[model samples]
Target: MSWTDLTATDLVPLPVVLPLLAAGLALVFARRPRVQRVVSVVALAGVLAVGIALLVLTDDRTLVVDVGNWAAPIGIDLVADRLSALMVTVSSFVLLCVLLYSLAQGVSEEAEEETESIPVSIYHPTYLVLAAGVCNAFLAGDLFNLYVGFEILLAASYVLLTLGGTGERIRAGSIYVVVALLSSIVFLIAIALTYAATGTVNLAQLSERLPDVEPGTRLAIQLLLLLAFGIKAAMFPVSAWLPDSYPTAPAPVTAVFAGLLTKVGVYAILRTQTLLFPTDPRIDQGLMWVALLTMLVGILGAVAQDDIKRLLSFTLVSHIGYMLFGIALATQPGTAAAIFYVVHHITVQTALFLVVGLVELRGGSTSLDRLGGLAKLAPGLAILFFIPAMNLAGIPPLSGFLGKVGLVEDGVRTGGFLAYTLVVGSVVTSLLTLYAIVKAWNKAFWQEAPQEIETDARVPRGMVVPTGALVAFGLALTVFAGPLYSYADRAAAALRDGSYVEAVFPDGHDRGVGESNETIPKAGAPAGPASAVDTGEGTP
Candidate 1:
């Protein structure tokens, strides 16, 4: 359908609806494995296309879909703007590629064996449900719907994490489920308190009302929300659960989780911090310290790892600090840099994990000691690993480098002691990430294989193609850095400007408009500089 024919509200729901419908179809065709694969892939691909369309259409405007045609504060609404659209689109593409890779590797086929622990018939359906949840979380316009979205994905993830039913997988699944459940409980409680305090769960309404709350109560709510999201984002001190949980799932499952799940939490933090709690010096400074420590501790953990998957997991946690660094800077450029890095990291990290899966297939293990001579055995896999690994390391001319540069430049421009310190920490973390990856490379691809280890047969083309595609996609981010950065800059600007709030509550009821102290620009208005200050107690 043409953009002229389809309104933003009409387009907003399709990304969530298509996968959910396909998931039901997948369940009905459970006995037909080929149909299941087709349904899952097509559903996700459709969502990806819809997300892209929404991104283009909503670049300059907000798309708000009120389910059941209900009005704001009482009805369920799905809002799509540039930020949500970008996240959903990029995540959908990653999910699709991972699905193709999983199918190619015959993971579902293997699961079908009576001897296997996971139910093969349920994989496709569950996967689609997970995708649906992800899109829902991205598009949700209310706190309750966002909470529901998290529960949906976490439920499906509990199933996916332990698919093989091996003791290791089961143990890992238990930890993941527990951590996820605990976070959900906290999130639900936060929702309850927010409603009790403000009498509305709609984000736009909350944005308008929350600032008027008592400072102590407001800070408490912000902390509760941050604590819940921090655990989900795998932030430091609360991040102990991630490395233990993620490495045990099947490669594709781990890849997608590593790529997208924590990011959803980061997205939540981004939305809430910019909208609900605009400028709290205390919270921003606290987050800065957390970011620095998360980076240091996570990369240190990675440096001590012997296995590639676990190593990547630690690095994954480490890089989240980079995004948090942007958030902590609380400036336009910093937020823009964080957005760019999120996109870069999602593709680069997912691709790296897929390459590790291939390494496992070729060398029989992901252990550095067990894996060697891969460059000679599977040159394509070596190249795949090399590209993303270098990108992840923040090597020059890659998207990772550009992202870091943006962040560092923001820090420099902001010129705070904490910001400057984080710049140094970020550089150190980048170098350490390179060291860890190079250690893996030297042992897995450069060094000679241990005679005791038996190398598997040639790597499958199915796996290689997807991995290479993601790697190429990451490079494309660099090749087209100008436009991509511009888009990210716009997204950050839109968010800081309160365009989302305007879109959700277009009637302008209680939006704090025309108040002398109001700092937030009206809907469709340009946001002021990040440095703009307002003494208005009621301003956002």
Candidate 2:
């Protein structure tokens, strides 16, 4: 269970590095969007391969790749363990689908033949850069490095979010950009405070050193980080921005935003809670309340919406509460449920969005009140939407059921009044989620339109491929839950113990102990009382 050291083969940088470089090349090839698509897909495929390889190589090892050959606690490094590798791998695939969906865009050509040129011709390249940034954030081992990754993608997202520069998109994006900037500033201030307190930015190093620090100071830093990340995760009170801005973007862009972006915020929270503040008592008493409220508020928002994408966006916000519920448990099964749900949500959410996009293309709008009877028109599109919506609502014989059952089981197993409240909230949210999806289906696909929903343009085969792939992945998660569970369990095991933190920096706090990065992946993952594995070893 003790993994001593890890090296490049173990900590391959392809997930981050390949995308980073390819983003620039994609920009270079923007004159030919098809070529840019090819380059981006190639880059993402590389990331996917490396991510899978790294997962196998990082059984128990904390794979670290020190940038510029500098030692930890002084120079920056990248940490690849079970959780990050899983996130990055999934992100790469999502971005790949986004790019593919983008390629078949006819709006550009449709507008090109008109008088004014479409302003957002650069969307493809910028989107790839944003993917690069997401990868960077997941792989980053240091807080500062994470900030850099965050900013990189945030900048690109602002561009992609406001692609058309329409007065409406600009107005919506203006608010989005400002709110996002303010949150980024909040994160920066917290990072500065942490660095001032510890004189270090490496998370692995902070994990090992923060315990000696005063509890009051640690709590302050933790709250600041939470506020910053919470806003981004769209958790309840700070989540209103998501429905407003996300629904305004073009369908493909919205799909990726739904599938990948908010999850980044949740991912940061998971890392912070598990790695930085695992032993905090308030997690049980107060955090549970936030999770419960988040789920309720989000699902409530979903029920009130008639726009399919907007409804899904609100539901996405609520679904995040499920992940946090697992995290609050701070147990192996709890974290494993969080991990499994992350993957399931990614595929299911993306497919639904892509289906919405397809509906938009065929029926010309996603509002249920304005559209109807699409199932009779395009049975194929109906099939795609049905599978994911049913899955999203946690129907049986699907991956969503597995994920929902895991969280519910974890909540019930950690029995108490608070656990009971969360368990009840989970059931209520699941029912509400089903009601919202069924509303969309009955009104948009099953019910008749007001004698207007009609379009002769075919949903192109190219446009269908990416969305179909997403649906297939969702079902595969159901059929292949075994291997997926094994990986999720391993990821949970690695997150459970501090074996990964130790392997990344073998000498621990002291730097001159002649430590060499080793190629051996940790033979076994570490396990302990999740509450007992505190990593706060930094300066007070």
Candidate 3:
């Protein structure tokens, strides 16, 4: 179909499909670096356009598409709501910029030496696959599809993480693969139990049936899902893999992984928490404690790190607690803030890692003891790093500060000893975050050189421009916070209300254009103000 002839439902899968198609074309053109670059860029740019269009289209409505036009509870489906739309848009922007940054890195490395450490033939296809996986996760409408998305990305990441085959990269990749496989196994078990209980793996269907399920069985399923998502989201105790695993990859790989991957996990938790089990306060309450501990532990680790990438990785985990803090509230304002925070973080964190890449290039190392006088050497780079660093530290008038304030206000309104304590923990984490960032700043940019730093290698303009564009995008969030926050509020309302469910099964029954012999059992809607089910009816 022509673009002009397509409906909103038709736009639902392009973000996932475009990348996979481009990945195949990229593989065919792998022998020609320029052709591969063009294909990758054009494909991601198309995805970015589609993502923005979907975001605008889904502003006031949720769109669902059953793959191959087959009915749900049997065939796979994709859903585009405000939450998923916003995630796709932001993640596409990040993915596009990181791709450009990596391309520039490759061109510059080739110019600098005879041997290229980054293999272009392997990089383009894998990166596009990574993009497809991320888009798939954001748009997935069921548990098994979500698991499929995770595996796609994990498989791509293994290749990216071990790109160089060096000892450190190999070791880090091994650790990462083991942890990811374990999480996948746990998630698979959770899906099995969910299907056995509800008779379908469709998320909208589960929202109706899960309430009638035995409370103990429901809780077990909820906790298992949380355990799996928590490991992926890198929540405290389970977050140990992130700091070590991320810092070993190429700077661009690390940037995208740190920026988009964990947030995908957080998005899963937010979707399932608010939609599938909003009535259950037991898990929400436990999430509050986990959020607090993750904040404290992650920031403490950040403060101790001298390597810039590892430091940023720890801070990445630390700031995730803020998103969790908002999710744990299970209120409209809290979720809106969490959604807003997710946007802020994806841009800011990715920009910071790209900047660190520049630092490594200019200074020959990422360690504080090995680097100094960067401000004098690269003033533009200094400005680039400083802006995002301060924003990350939550300085006034930045998106980070605004997002944190929203979370704190809601926490105070939540009004329990734990809520108040989380409020306090949020403040302390921000302050400690400032301390860690400032320490990195002083040591790397302002402190006297520990030795004579190499000044011959020029920081690539190709790399700097993309990095700067991302930094500017983060700043734009601060400028646009009012409208964006309002959008998030509406999105949160849709999640809290039954609008998402209503949109999926418009007549209160299983829906699609194709036939399914399988039947969805009818069940009464759960009794609660928080439940998002509108009808107890099921498809027959």
Scored by lDDT, the top model is: 3
On the 0 to 100 scale, the lDDT of residue 363 in model 2 is 90
Model 2 TM-score is 0.91
After superposing candidate 3 on the true structure, give the runs of residues whose Cα lies further than 4 Å from its correct spot: 1-6, 107-119, 510-540
lDDT of 1 at 79: 84
> Which residue runs of candidate 1 sit more than 4 Å off their true CA positions?
1-6, 114-117, 452-456, 511-540
lDDT of 2 at 260: 90
* TM-scores of all candidate predictions against the true structure: 0.93, 0.91, 0.93
Candidate 3 residue-wise lDDT, 204-231, digit = tens: 8888888999998899999999999999
Better of 1 and 2 by TM-score: 1
For all candidates in order, the CA lDDT equals 0.87, 0.78, 0.87
For 69-145, candidate 2 gives per-residue lDDT tens digits of 66565657777777887888788777787677767765334334432545334665677678878988898878888
Which candidate order results from sorting by lDDT in descending order?
3, 1, 2
Off by over 4 Å in 2: 1-11, 106-121, 510-540
